[model samples]
Target: EHGRGPCDCAEFLVTLVERLTQRIERHWNGIDDLADDLEEAVLDEAGPEVGATLVDLRRQAIILRRYLQPQRDALRALQTGQPAWLESDDQRHLAEELDALERVVEDADAMRERMALVRDELNGQASERLNRNMYLLSILSAVFLPLGFLTGLFGINVAGLPGTGEPLAFWIFVGALVIVAALQLAVLRRMRWI
Candidate 1:
């Protein structure tokens, strides 16, 4: 009851808007830091935690946009409507706050885009790593399959297996196995599988 007028109320609202703008600026800075963290995590080939962090960053950006978009629209409407109670000075102050809000919104949008790019890069790196590991496993399996078959065959209790009784037979079989391995390696190298 201090006899405040309509202009006083408008001034108070402007002050509140200014404070909100300042807070949003701080929020935008926090988002910037998060984005930097995400980039570093990607470069370091961070694990699932990076994905979770990216999700959190995106969620924060979405929430910020959710609140900001409407506030921006209202400010625009106020500026365009120019109510009789809002003095010219109040309108100017609101315009400045609106500009600040717009810049923060743009920064948030850019940060989101950057996060998306980092996520794609992380996925690509993971997929490439998986493919390389699978290729190595396949090569190992290829190299070992014949060796396993030879060992199993020689271990069988069948009679009349060639060179079974000779004193050099074991060494000869070993030599044969080494030859087979060399041949397989040659073929694999020719095919560029290694």
Candidate 2:
């Protein structure tokens, strides 16, 4: 009804590219926010969920870049090729769109890199925590190993265990175990393992 012709195609394309660029910019901002959250989550030890969110964000960034690159390239070509149908004004508008697209693509790439760094930091923290936990467990096992052995030796129902006949043997054995634990702790402290 408006009697628009093929010459208007350039205007339509420009508008479409502008809308797409805006959407991509919004996505970039969201990814930026997520990156910030990931850093905070890492510091708080927020666990596997943060990792999953990072993975999703990385995937989104990759997909955005993947799509945006071709659009940017097409826009560049459209501006340079200058099809006979496109007026100088159309070419100018397309050039502006191309610039916007290029910026958004760069933003996507930068966001991906930022997410990668966050992932590495998260992995480092998790590894450190695991190592610390293992160290504590090893120390506990060392302290208990001798105590366990003593109990096992006395528990055997074989011939005359000297403590078996004495009413105070159990108390003595308990005291002995406590002393052993205390000694182990002292040794650990001296070695600075604690």
TM-score of every model?
Answer: 0.89, 0.90
Model 2 residue-pair collision total: 0
Give the clashing pairs for model 1: none
In candidate 1, what are the lDDT values of residues 129-153, reduced to their tens digit?
A: 9999999999888888999899899
Q: Model 2 over residues 1-194: C-alpha lDDT tens digits?
A: 67663347777887787788788888788878877878888888897899889999999989989988888899888877889988898888888888888888888888889888988988898999999999999999999999999999999999888978889999999999999999999999999999
- Candidate 2, which segments miss by more than 4 Å at Cα? 1-7
Q: Which candidate number has the best lDDT?
A: 1
In model 1, what is the error at residue 164, expressed in angstroms? 2.0
User: What is the lDDT, from 0 to 100, of the residue 90 in candidate 2?
Assistant: 80
lDDT of each: 0.90, 0.87
Candidate 1 accuracy as TM-score: 0.89
Global Cα lDDT for candidate 2 = 0.87
User: What shift in Å separates residue 123 of candidate 1 from its native position after superposition?
Assistant: 0.7
Model 2 compared with the native: what TM-score? Answer: 0.90
